[model samples]
Target: MNRRRTPRSASAEELLSTLQHLTARARQEVGLHQARVELAQALQGKMLPAALPSFPGIRTAARYAPARDGLDIGGDWYDAFLLPDGALGLAIGDVQGHDVEAAAFMGQIRIAMRAVASTAADPGEVMARTNDLILSMDSSLFATSSFFRLDPATRELAGARAGHVAGVWATADGRSGITSDAGGLPLGIETGQRYPVTRRTLDVDGVFVLLTDGVIEGPSLSIGDGLEEVRRLVSAHTGATAEELADRVLRAAVLTGHEDDAAVLVLCHEVTPRDHG
Candidate 1:
């Protein structure tokens, strides 16, 4: 008995054509992904401040690193500027998502917060005002933020939070711990929310470190462990300048290929003869 053989549905020529088409489509997809990544990074870079403001007795520094995965854009951002009242304004925040919309929302929020802070000069009020502004936008977005005002002349520090990660306060002798106060719901989540300000008289030689969650939540470590690692790294650089310290913290805590963007701000009040007197 002779058996009948089944014919192949796809010829060699057809298979080759299909493979070629798939290869071309793959290349197109890769190109599109690259363009998106580039655009996102550029938009984020423009949104963040190029340099932090400086003062006589206070040293300010900030660093932002884009995500090395996905779109290379995230909502992490930090800003420091001279307020109209002569108080240094510092803020670090992370918007809800890691898309282009999130990045654009972050820029608007940062600008709005700065404008509010320049006039209000109150950390709690600034956050509250920004919260109201975000609600007015009518977008499905929210953000966690820490807003602070520091008087370099008097070494007075005040801050408020909207469900953001706590900052680090390091003494002159290298001891450090989390510094956080009363916090309210994240901004844009609820209108007319109240954020209570926390005030502290930091030592003349103390440092206040503000950071986004990406800094304290490492790829392979828990937040607690990451905090400890940051403390250790910061302790080793107690004598470094604010900029140097910021760089060191990023180098030690954040890696090159982070899953999320990382942002940090460091404020240091150096003691002088007047402070001693």
Candidate 2:
């Protein structure tokens, strides 16, 4: 003969106790996640330059915004600093993802690039050396970056790209086009990658826009359409100040529902009354 067993029914107090335990665990998890996000954002803020240094004959402005979807802290960054030899070094890059790991990787790469800018001969050397450094770190994350060295006195712009977005060059008269001569794979893709240096004599009255892909690319927009939109925006702001133009571009991208973090750095020679005369 076999006997059937009955399931035990818990008392109300026991059930309440179990519910309380689960609630506490849930709260703990949420708290931990929030803390992680705040830490990541704070780290990002510290990594990015707080203020752009003033250049005598050049106007530069940069803007960075984290993606609104995820933790709101991402790997997109922009930097502009004066080198030892009087050249202005401008860099913008995006790591592989928009996570805490990606943010950490971006910080490392930005710091390394800044340290190398002092001794690196040119933009090509900077990218090449940075690529090597990232590889040596044994990191799995890769980054797309563009480095430019501008001589304000001579109006000479030399730069190199590592699978990054093409820069835009527009004169004060509204003539505009993309500047992407020397381009290669993103950093950390391989052990040895050479970034060709592209040299251009930028007109004193023109603007050089270096940006991350997030400004133009999003879930809803194709890359081609995004680039066209950016070009149109740039063309419309032919005579706007660098700060104004950067603000407009960043606002447009955000309002249009850009799904990723975005960064923009605008460089233009400051034309004085003497130049016009």
Candidate 3:
């Protein structure tokens, strides 16, 4: 009778060894995920402006918030720099992913924009040149951006957009509306795309608010609704300083259970209300 003998149980040391190996592997995976998250965070930290460029008669404040509970980093970025003609240049953009690559790409795009804008005279030319540079890299990713050249003394803004969401602006007398500028396709879409530019001057004590889509759009919300919401926020809080207004806008976005990264840049031409006399 060739009956199968009962299988012997694994020895205690053997079982312990197997468990130790599994535990090591589990911990290794956890550590790897954490390391990747940290690396993305670092990339994002370096990509953001350490301090927004300060100029006379221009009070600027910017804020950036991560998505997914900080488990990942998205490609939202804001930059303020000095243009060649002494105009203050400002930009807000969102790259198309949420990972280390996105963060790195965002950093490169901001640097490229600053470099290109410093020498370019027209907002349209700046966008075209930047589009070409981004395509030269052969990256498959795309990005949406809003660029502005502002004369601090006049608060005259020459703006361009590349498939970005509309920004909201508020005047000292409490009038607020979408920036409603002409726009082009997002960068990396095609070669030689020309972006249209618009020019507007902020009234004394006027404010212009720029932000990523993350601030406005939610799963159930449309872009138009989000824009209106931001406009209301801006109009309702004109009394707030640039910093306070930035916080208010960002706080509203956060309260809506936002699932993406958000960046807000608030520019106030003058803090004091315009004299009606």
Candidate 4:
């Protein structure tokens, strides 16, 4: 009798019930995640997000991804605005920690940056003033950032870096690589420090990218190798729109594992053909 005994299979009703429970659980989890994200953003109370700002001959796009196990938020932030002189101001940065204070500090830094940029002559002065402002806060927080003044007519970017990652660039016609920008210490460290300004012009149809280190360097990836991978990707995907390009880069980083909060800003230079009339 034992030799002929076999396990009984579950009925159709039982299997169906199990599937239904799993589906409902998945939906519940997704809703909870969305609620948490909204709550966190509401708590921050400041919008440092980089929404696309319109400019002649330029299409701007940005993406932000939180750490894998983060509170669905962190110190990473990106911002773009029109300067008083009509030039476009672009910035991306990360504060020293990942907490409520860090998020608040990031917001302050952005607001101060815009205020200083209104009167500052160039990217260098903007950063120096922001640096001094942070020191005045009396908080021990430090941050790394990149500030750029983009000239729409000339297609030139005047930029300054403060102990942050150098940006990457590419074109619609297959030219791509990392930018070489000299920089100074992270903000909030010294009372008087100078950040070098790097200026470069983009050819028509070319694109310039600004990204936080979280997008490239990870636990399983080295910054050097990650830079090369990004270079190859940007060069190969030449026909993508600014938004598409930004998403593709973020997707790649997610695949590698997002060890920190990530943010990227893209400037797509588009030139219109002259009218035949």
Best by lDDT: 3
Candidate 4 regions off by >4 Å? 1-36, 43-46, 273-277
Instruction: Give the lowest summed-lDDT range of ten residues in model 2.
Output: 268-277
> Which of the numbered candidates is closest to the native, going by highest TM-score?
1
State the lDDT at 49 in candidate 2: 93
Of 3 and 4, the candidate ahead on lDDT is 3
Q: How does candidate 3 score on lDDT? A: 0.86
Better of 1 and 2 by TM-score: 1
TM-score of each: 0.87, 0.84, 0.85, 0.83
164-273 in candidate 3: lDDT tens per residue? 98899887686889977889999889998999999987756777999998888877566788888889989988777889999999987864568899999998887444
Off by over 4 Å in 3: 1-34, 69-71, 271-277
Q: Candidate 4 lDDT, tens digit per residue, 1-277?
A: 5697688999999999999999999999999988887876675535565355866667788988776665667788888898877889999998877667788888889899989998996899999999999999998899999999988777788999999988888877667889888999999899899999999886567778888888888877888777777778777775677789899888778645677888888887777622222
Model 1 ranges with Cα > 4 A deviation = 1-26, 254-257, 273-277
> Among all windows of ten consecutive residues in candidate 1, which has the lowest summed lDDT?
268-277
lDDT of 1 by residue, 35-88 (tens): 897798789889999888877667888888776666788889999888877888
Judge candidate 4 against the unseen true structure and give its global Cα lDDT, from 0 to 1: 0.83
Q: Model 4: how far is 26 from its true place, Å?
A: 15
* Candidate 2 per-residue C-alpha lDDT over 124-154 given as tens digits, one digit per residue, 9 for 90 to 100: 8899999999999999899999988888777
**Candidate 1 local Cα displacement, residue 154, angstroms:** 1.3
lDDT for residue 200 in candidate 2, whole number 0-100: 84
